[model samples]
Target chain A: MNIEMIRAAQARLEGHARRTPLLNSPFLDEIAGRRVWVKPECLQHTGSFKFRGGWSAVSGLDPEARARGVIAFSSGNHAQGVALAASRHGVRSIIVMPSDAPQSKIDNTRALGAEVVLFDRAKDDRNAICARLSEEHGLTLIVPYDNPLVIAGQGTCGLEIAEQASAEGITKADVLVCCGGGGFTAGVALALEADAPCLRARPVEPEDFDDMARSLASGVIERNSRLSGSLCDAIITPQPGNLTFPIVSRLAGPGLVVTEDEALHAMAHAFSRLKLVAEPGGAVALAAALFHADEIEGEDVIVTISGGNVDADVFRMALDKFGG
Target chain B: MNIEMIRAAQARLEGHARRTPLLNSPFLDEIAGRRVWVKPECLQHTGSFKFRGGWSAVSGLDPEARARGVIAFSSGNHAQGVALAASRHGVRSIIVMPSDAPQSKIDNTRALGAEVVLFDRAKDDRNAICARLSEEHGLTLIVPYDNPLVIAGQGTCGLEIAEQASAEGITKADVLVCCGGGGFTAGVALALEADAPCLRARPVEPEDFDDMARSLASGVIERNSRLSGSLCDAIITPQPGNLTFPIVSRLAGPGLVVTEDEALHAMAHAFSRLKLVAEPGGAVALAAALFHADEIEGEDVIVTISGGNVDADVFRMALDKFGG
Candidate 1:
């Protein structure tokens, strides 16, 4: 992808994407044995970093295409992001979601003015339905991860981080971001590596998946199907996207995998100390920083808290696990 | 008592207190039938507006007094606030808390490096304990609300709201603040009324402790012993304070009372829609705005979310009430 395209996307998303606070936590700093800064995208509109790409992709369409509207397939944050973004721009949005998607996400998407079409993952194909909807309605398909415009939108989060850290006199740090299909981490790495040359970007994953880590070691993109039974549903994708894999390969400095227990612990920590309602995926980077403190000790670190859209049941489960 | 003293306290707290976000909620606006802005002090360090006063009071002590340390009595946010604030200033703090105070607050104060001295409210006099501790340790007593320094610190929150609203092109609005002992509301009123002459400041109370409302109607301070069995522990005080009453009387426009159900519903709404963890007391103002939509229709309004120190058990109970 052209770097200038990403910059243009950032420009288009300037006022739309929230310039979320880069909060400092002395307790977290102590826990990580490093100076810790959190970029709270969890506080972003639609409760996630998905809004960056959702707004970017939707807003970049030509007026005629925008008139036709947009469609996306997701069971989580991206659905709400697209719905909210499309509504904000006065365009219709159609979200194709799995039947088992959390009720909260479904309600939130519909509340944001989206037409939600549910398909059973056990009995039907979500991608095929989304494709059919896009074609039938003449709606532009805005893929959550594979699209270039989406990656560019996600990169705006990194731009904000670099600007905030620089303003606070922080010139160098290790940045940890949670990875699923790598859209968020890829975008963050590209922006941080380009603007803050001294900073190192590490993409973290659930130990169950770790496809990016495997792919990085093998010098080629690889797919894994062992991503199951994890508390972090949002980052349980089986493989990194083709478009994002290359960007991740070029920009990410290292790869780390954390246990599900670590993610739950981190989520609890965030709720108790920071008073933030971070979803499991959003807490993964901070979890890695805290659980693997020795590796990043004494370093200035920035963790991206990517979303705050956990299902009530999932949150309750996490609370129970952590003895809240 | 001196205006310059408040200015001096502000200067002392320049870099300490967080300039918390003033979030504009389109969802809340639609629900409240008005333009609503949330001043989220719940996101402040120690998860409350009390931190502003705590930090300011702790940091303002002379070197000799700082060396001697400080003492305070609180069962909730104020306890954590003083503990965290004193820790930030490297001053030792002793907190006299009710033994029945939530474990989260107790644990948090201990985590912040304060000595926790638990007392049974029914059997022990907390004030006597604090006095004895202060005398024994040569520590300065930091009263939570009655002190001028603490009031000045609390006023800084109002100062920030005024600046944030002005920056957002909101020249004036009716500001609703939840009242405990009246420090927070009085401080907010003072700052907003002084800085934005057209802004109206109103105090909100839980139906059980409608002391501010009764006082306003009677044109004199009134004390009540009736305690409403409600979830908002932070603002369930029996009456307004001597120091805070005069300030509140001079600056506040009117007082509003809201039901316990309204407070709980607001807490759930904030959590689900805004993704904010607001304690019940902190949400009471928003609750009034939400439940009393007709009273505030078509008006520009701002509500203060005073804290986010709700216990996990309390949160679960409230969520159950809201059918979560």
Candidate 2:
């Protein structure tokens, strides 16, 4: 996918999805020691940026294929995204989500009129489950981050960031994107590289699940051995996507990682100052902006808060511990 | 306050504050039985609509008056707002706050560079304190609301709502405004009356603290007997402001009131669906939108989320009780 494809995705998404706002806080700027523009994709459909890719993929499907429905495997955000997108297209959807996923995610996905097939997180293979289910149901499998159209779809967010930044007269800047399978980060980077060459993308992740960061540094695809317990569960991909890695490697800088505590602090700050609900995973990039301020390359920065679907318990804990 | 004064306030606040987005969600709309556009003043500077009024009041002051600084008496959002507004103008601020106010609010106000004077909530009269301080130190006392400039400043939010609704091709609408001293509601109503006569403002309040509702009905300033114990501490004004009551009574509908539980549910819904952090007081209008949907008189509606200075424990309880 190139600039044209990304622009096509942006046009396709125009009326279908929201153009989430770029938020700014003078107080937050004081904290980060720089001017920061926050893109709240938490306000996106399905409460995450995954909705962009899901909608893009679903909407791009042929009439017959769309009528037959689609299938995807994700523990939370992606599942809800695909389910909502398919429902919007008047298509049936079957989502293979982990049984251990938050009850809210499962319930919300099901509420969107999708059939939820919950597999055991510890034992069942989600990929295998999705494959067998898709084949049996004759459904198109919507890979979360590995498709060209989906990559282009996610690229629209980057397009907005670049457009918004440029509109704000920010020419030389860096965007800190929270990374999962490198889909969002790669797409954003490619769009920025193509459209606004002055802006750069910096991938951010939680400490242990920093495969994208390591991969960017090592100039190769690096993998995380364990991802079962990271606080930033939304962006805990084992490794960067095959389609996304190349674009990310070429267009983005070395990844930035923040600790669990820093992410919690970022979430708290978002709650008290920005007045936005930022899930811990969604706030990693914010953590990078606030805590790793010195490491970021530019004066003007964009921090992508990618999702807001935190468990009530975890959110309460963050508020209690890091509030004030 | 008239449209011209409100426009002047808007012009004065152009480069200083945020024009917070008017958020919409299909899910929230479904719950309300109509298309509901949420104006989250939660995103305003100092995390509430008070900043608009504060900035308006402070900026409207003469150069010499601004140089001498200002004094305000409040426990939470308004204090912080005045402090922040004063700080922005390079003016010194002295806030007389109750000792029982949340530590977070007090800390945030101080952090914004205000000198905080803590008085006992039960024993001390904040009005007397402010009066004495203003007279003794020659400081201009910035009333939280009631003032014409502050009301005009807050009217900018109403103008934005009307303009946004018109932009979306909505001509007839009901705007649910959370009511405390009626300043915001009256200002918004007056603005809507002048600019977008097709739109109407509806004042919403907590169940027992329905002074605005009763006052609107009786054409008198009805006061709440108990003020300090309501969960919505931010908007627990004893009665509608002397200056603001007449406008609100004449312009708004019979005020809508919601139960505490409904307000808490609104807060939880805001956290999960709108991905906005709304304090209980802020969520009152949302409660009216969600729980009192039938009473709201238009297909196109606007819900004002007034503030987001909730205590961590209160927010946690809301999330736990009503969060998905």
Candidate 3:
């Protein structure tokens, strides 16, 4: 929660994470009624922003902890991020993924040299399995969101955006980020507040998991259905993390909810218009901007396109739904 | 046509044209029956390698010629590339595009501050319009290909690939490039010959306009029908350029022809597995590698993914065709 810690993390991650291009989309600019800048983390190594956090966390660990390696529980982008980062650092990685996770995700993790243990989300507890693995192997548990280092690491993205925007003569932004455990949004808010103080940060979520939005309005943590099948598989968690919720509650702006259809439409639009392959979760923030254009009229906006790791079959289904 | 001139062009375009990433794909490597390295010009500015030629041609012009502006005629990626490069150089650009050009491309060109003059490709002479514009406005005609400067510019891509492959312990490559006016293939061949003497370059074309293949086999220039309504819109020209043909004849090893279905499948595979957006013409070389794996067996291979500028409707059709 320390702003200096976030700044230090940004300094630590300089040159390590790609300074992903802030691509201009005149097509999106025309449609949005304002200039739109896309921070394409989808082009990041491991095909997601999660790599930033994973790399930061792993690299910042004490030598003893680093020697023990890392463990993470995720079914998608984070799994790849940790696996790739750990492999790059010559550290072993153990990933606990749901049994129903897409074959592509599992395969990518394995390709990155991670040891994947599949758990049935419907019948077993992922966290318990992850804990067991961490304990058994004496590995450091690298939680996907709740850890302080992870949040600070994710903040580097916002730092880059602020620097890039300033260089482009942009002093303010209505920043939209897709929210799951609130880790990404909280980290981004902290960085924006520290750097581009005038910028506003908002978290966008699927209608099915509107807990973050509900929590923001009530100023309290909230939980949603544990079994909702949201279009954004990456952000379909039931609740925001405890550590993230506090930082988000104190620093984050209001949250917006977009329907599954809107997310699909945004994904198709991004793929065709911007020539970017944004996964459903990554497209959610842009979907909110598009679906609620009237609300954001005349504002200079920056949308964090989070990842590009969707299964081919799921990508086709989304494209079909959006008539692309 | 001079190899040294092409090398000079590569030097001039060093920092201007992106040394686009030469991505390694394990899946593609497995399918290619060799180590597969992809030169992703599809990720270049304006989403194609044409930007290289456009930049080189415009930058090499005398100051007075540059001040007078430039003009081109095209129905696809070339229009946007010229427009964007001209805008970057603070020069006026007039594009004589066919009325049937994809609306998205036309709009993109206009957005880059180019003057778009539309003519019916079937009923009117596009060259005549371009000539008249040049005469009236004193504009420099920047031919898309069939010009020495343009060929030199496109050669930079091949130079980058050869250097990058060498860095990765690959000294030789069976390079596959999609051919249109033979500009890209010729440029690539010149660069490969200069940088990696052991490398062999092959141009791949749609079966409908297999002039390059026939000409290479028969040792004579051959003309074919101007292919129309093909998925590979970017490379449907009737023949290789007069300047480029001789370079290809002297440097290229062979030519390959791919089916329309194979190109679409490659596009989809790029989208799904490689996380790249590849137009049909851009995917043709990859299609040849995938479909003709037996022919290219055990060879270190590099495919130039030329562009990523497909219409939304056409992309959807390709997705469906590939079961994406």
Candidate 4:
């Protein structure tokens, strides 16, 4: 919500989080026709920047509240992030995921010391299920994007980008961030506003899941007609969070969107040039930076590769399509 | 090469080389049954630690010699490393490679501002070709692993490891390095000997191309029977370097070798757990650390992913074989 709160989250995250490298390649620079600096958050703990928000929210909880445990409703990156954070914090984490979720996701969550509670997405309301579970266990719901602490935690990435950019003598650039429910976008925009005033944050999304882009264009909250089917499943929320939308609207640059193919292509480039694995959602910002260069301004551009918790087959498909 | 020379290279490489991150995963730790820290040199410039040695050798040249440029004979990581290094230093680079080498490799070297001279592997002597090119162009030969300054450059990676390990409170551990002609292994060993004496460097190689290992066991330089068939082609040198062998033998712990299958399996794990794109040659040290855990003597192990220049098909095959 604020720079102080984000700084506080960064204090909690010290040593616990990996201050991932700002990766670049001449190949990428040539392709984009500009200086491309990549913040590979895929290399972060839990293979995603989600770990930052997870740790922030969990660690920010009061001692008594923290002792009761926490719950998250996700079958993807957030589940693993919260699971690991809670385990590291020595508290039980209950993850509510659809039974239809990939077995790897279920297994990975459990492996991170979380109690996996599966629900039928088609027949059961996940929110209702989470509410009941939270009530029964006296657990705090670790909202994925809507919470203040979570936004502050995600803001830590923005803080890193600001410092790293300054170190590279980059004072001004458009920072493309892959957006799900706008927590990362809003957090980064706030941090950049406070720390690196000239570096602007822009939300990037998949073509069909461009609710943030649409919302920014319309100057109001917008919703996606459909989700779930995108290759960028890690960031396919139906709508931007109310808490995050206001902040993004106020401080962020216009949102950008890339097609699924573009995201996969960016994933391949990330693999071949940056030597980093990036999930489709994680690669959307990079996709925008590489393919949508005309829409962006400035000589230098920064992009956040948010996660790499991708399935092997999907990653192979990406490489096959784009030739790593 | 001693630590002072390494420190000098570090000074010359202060802003040019990437200080790649030390990445880890609980999943990898569980598999290794010990804490595993991966120094991902694959994320270094030109997607390998070779850049360190390349820059060291090129930058250490006298003004007249540097202006005359540099030449190297490699179809893989070294070619790219030296090419990029020379280009950045505003000097011409000539790379002599086998005509049968992958076209991608040839094209990539050229794209990095290097002049590529192809020769027949069966009939042409690459060393003679390089010698001719060097004389014709008044170019200093940038030996891949044998030069003192090259070793000093690679030693900078060791310096980083010692500092990072100390920051993590790791005083003692085996630092597994993917070894070819022993340049990287020797450099790291010399640096660790001075900085973190408790951290011992060990050379890792592919099964058949284990010249470094055999040389260490015999307490003398030894040669491989053949070098072209290994999947880890980047490290398929015929023999250990004369300059590197003595330092490695004196300062290094021992040598480790892993099978092609093990390297591929480790590559899969790196992609899955660490979100790193590690080629088979690069993954050998990680393979040794994970599958050869019993052979190692420590609760913590540090492995370097030497390079990530594998073809897309090869990376997919690795994933298919091991399930990333």
Candidate 5:
């Protein structure tokens, strides 16, 4: 919520997190008609920036609570990130996921040393399962994006962007962030406000799932009717988090929305030009930066590729449709 | 080349060359049965480490000579490297490539601000064309890996590895390099010899194109009988360079070789786990570290993914066969 808390999270994540580099390609700049720099958090541990938040929240727990173990609910990137964080801290983790989730996600979460509990999306109540498990095992639940410590952890990436941008003599630019529950956008907005005020944070989402954009425009929280079926499945939260909405509304710029095709195009460009793998959800910010250039203001823009955990078939589909 | 020249190249390349991170995956470690660190130079400028050597050679020329421009003969990575380097230096570049080379490579080279002159690989003499063009334009011909300055430029990667390894508290390990004309291996070997002496450089090549391994064992230069039919075409050189062979022979460990299948497998792993796009030739060192684990020594190993410029079909083929 504040710069000090984020800096405190940075202290906990000093050596634990990978300080991913800010990468750029002349070809991407040409396409965008402006300078384009990408912060590839896809290269972060567990192939996503979620690892930052996972570690931050896990490590921030009291010694007794950490010893009691942790629990989380995520069918994708968050599952893997929290699992690995808990495993590394020598703490047990119980992940509650929908049985309909990708098998690879289930396998990868378990491979990272978590005990995965699957529920039916149409039948079983996920929250009840998590509640029972947490109550029985005395496990602390690591919320995906609504927690303050988690936001602080995600803010570390913003600090890195500020420092890297300064080194590149980039004092002013729109910092596009992939938005879900808005923890990442809120965190980045807070960091940039305190450290690099000229670099404003902007949220980007898929076309149909533009709750953040609607909420920003209406000055009130908005909700999406559907969350599934989008190519950018990883960031399809129904609405922005209560804790995050206020921060983002105060400090961030107007949100932007991009199509699934634009996300695929951005993924292909990331693979071909930046040599980085980017899932559709992680690529929305990059999509906005490259395709929605007219909506953006500035000679240069910084965007985040938040994660890279796409299935092989989906990845091939992206490359096939977009030409890597 | 000695350490001083490499240090000087490091100075010149301080901001120009990307200091790619040494990335690792717990999954890769599980497969290798040891700690494995990968330096993904595939993320470097021009999608290869070739950019380092290109810039070093071009920038090392006298101001007057550089003003006259430069020329080079390459069918793939080298052409793009030199073209980008020359273009960045505000000098002209003429790249001589075989007409049979991949169309994407030709287009990419020209896109990087180079004049492309294609010759028939079967009948036309590429050297004759290069010589004539060099004489006519007063352009200095930049050799790919044989020049001392080029080697020095590549050595800067070794220096970075030395520092990164020391940071990780690794005093000893085999540093694997994907070998072609041996310039990269030789440069890294010389760098390790002076800085991280306990870390040994080892050359890795495709099974059919194991000229560096053969030359190291025989204590003389050896040539491959056929050069055109390998999955790792980017590294199928005829023989080790006259300048590079001696340095590698004196400083590096016995060489290693992996099959085309193994390279494809490594590429898949890089795509899935490391979020990196590695071409077949570039993945050879990683292949050696992973599938050829028994042939290597120690608890830790460092490997380089040299480039990422595979065609979409080839990449799809690798993914289809290896299951990215």
Candidate 6:
């Protein structure tokens, strides 16, 4: 929650986490009608920004706690992030994943030497299962968001963006980030508030799954009802986290939402022009930058591609549907 | 090209070109059975290593020479690189391109403010046409790879790899470079010889168009008889350049050739794992690194993804054919 903690998290994750590049595309700039700088977390360790938080949380633990290991519940970028971070420290990790989660995420988490407990999303409660496992094993629970340590870890991304943007002579800009449970968005908001006040951080989400956007607007935590099936499965968390909601609501500006079609188009553009593989969830901010350009008031805009671990079939479909 | 000229080129291209990241993948390392590092020039300005040569040549010109502008013949990465570099310098660039070249390349070159003169590759001598244009317009002729300034510009890639590898505690490495006219490979060879003698540079080429491989072995320039049908069209130069061959022959080790399938697989791996787009020609070195691991002898292996300017259809086929 503080800049010092974020700096500490950055130091803890240094050399382990990749400082993902700040990319610029003239093509995207043309579409956005301003300079567009992209922070591609798709290139991060474990193919997402989750690695920064995972490493920060895992590495920040006391040696005794680290030896006892950790447990968490997630089936997306967070699973692989925590798994990789735990393995790096020679600590055991157990990820409670949905039974029908993408095979790649499960396999990758296992490959990182983490034990995966599969539960049916329709029939079983992942949180209850994770709680039982954590208590039974006397393991620390590393929350996907909400946890101060995890938020501090995610805040490093904001710090990096500020430093890199400053280096590129970007003193002030409109920065758009993809929001899932508001973990990264809140962290980025806090970091920007401390380090680079010039960068106005906003959360972008899928049309139907705009929990964080609604939360910021209504001045309370919000939840998404099953209205429409979304392609951005990586970020379909039902509600904003208790801890993350306050940070985003207090520190961040307004949020934006983009359609599934727009996200797919952004994915295709990333493939063709930016030369980056972005999952649907990761492409939301880009969708906003490209499709809702007129609403973005700034000299420059920074969009974050949050992850790149989509199913092969899904990627092929995006390329087929929207690619030139 | 000498080290001094390369240093000068680096100085000239300080903020003009991107210092592309050298990426490592555990998945690639597991397949290669050794540590493998990749320098992705696909992230370079104009989407390829050609920009280095292009910028180096354009920026190296005297002020009056720059005023008359420059001309070159190529319908690939070079065309866009030259066009962009010339535009940056506020100079006129006339690109003599093949009529059948990819539309994306033509559009990009023209978008960068170059005047395009399309000619039949099968019927007209592109060099003759370029020469006539240069004479008529009093424009400086920028050879794609043969010029020392261009080669020196390309050598900056080698300098960066050495510096980055040394930072990672890599002392000795086997570097595989994609070869067309051997500008990049030869420049890399010279730069490595000067700064990082511990790293050995090797040339990689498409299977049938293995002119650099043959030239390295025979002590004479060997030409590929036919090239129109090759998938690696960006790098299908008939033979090694006169200026480049000698440097590569003198400093670099044996050359390697990869099949079109292998290059496509490399492109897919770059897409799926490294999260970078790589053209077929750009992916050849990666193919050599991944598939020809047994032949490489060093503490670590390094491969360069030289470009990312393939047509959408070509890229889609690469993803479908080889992606996970």
Which digits, one per residue and each the tens of the lDDT, describe model 5 over residues A100-165? 888888888999999999999999988999999999999999989999989999999999999999
Against the true structure, candidate 5 reaches a TM-score of 0.99
Across residues A277-316, which tens digit of lDDT does each residue of candidate 1 receive?
7888888898988888766633688898888887666666
- Cα lDDT tens digits, model 4, B1-324, are 578999999999999999988888999999999999999999999999999999999999999999999999998999999999999999999999889989999999999999999999889988888888889889999888989999999999999999999998897899999999999999999999999999999999999889999999999889999878788998889899999999999999879999999999999999999999999999999999999999998889999999999999999999999974
Local accuracy of candidate 2 as per-residue lDDT tens digits, A1-324: 788888888887887778888888777888889898999999888889999999988888888888889998887888888898898888999988888777877888898779999899789877888889887878999988888878888899999988888879998988999999988988899899887999999899999899998998988899998978888998998899999999999999889989999999999989877888888999999999999988987777899999998877788878988974
lDDT of 4 by residue, A72-153 (tens): 9998999999999999999999999999999999999999999999999889999999999999999999999999999999
Q: For model 6, which pairs clash? A: none
Question: Which DockQ value does candidate 2 get?
Answer: 0.64
- Writing each residue's lDDT as its tens digit, candidate 1 over B106-185 gives 88789988999999978998888888899999999998788888888888888888888887788668889988888888
| Lowest lDDT 10-residue stretch of candidate 6 chain A | A226-235
Deviating ranges (above 4 Å) for candidate 1:
A120-128, A168-171, A226-230, A295-297, B1-7, B226-230
Docking verdict class for candidate 5: medium
Q: Backbone collision count in every prediction?
A: 0, 0, 0, 0, 0, 0
Docking class of 2: medium
Q: What is the overall TM-score of model 3 with all chains considered together?
A: 0.86
Candidate 2 stretches with Cα past 4 Å from truth are: A62-64, A119-138, A167-171, B120-125, B132-138, B169-171
TM-score of each: 0.93, 0.93, 0.86, 0.99, 0.99, 0.98
Q: Is the docking of candidate 4 incorrect, acceptable, medium or high quality?
A: high
Interface RMSD per candidate (angstroms) = 1.9, 1.7, 2.6, 1.3, 1.4, 1.5
TM-score per model (chain B): 0.95, 0.98, 0.96, 0.99, 0.99, 0.98
Error of 5 at B282 (Å): 0.3
Q: Alpha-carbon error at B51 in model 4, in Å?
A: 0.3
* Selected candidate, larger DockQ, 2 vs 6: 6
Docking class of 6: medium
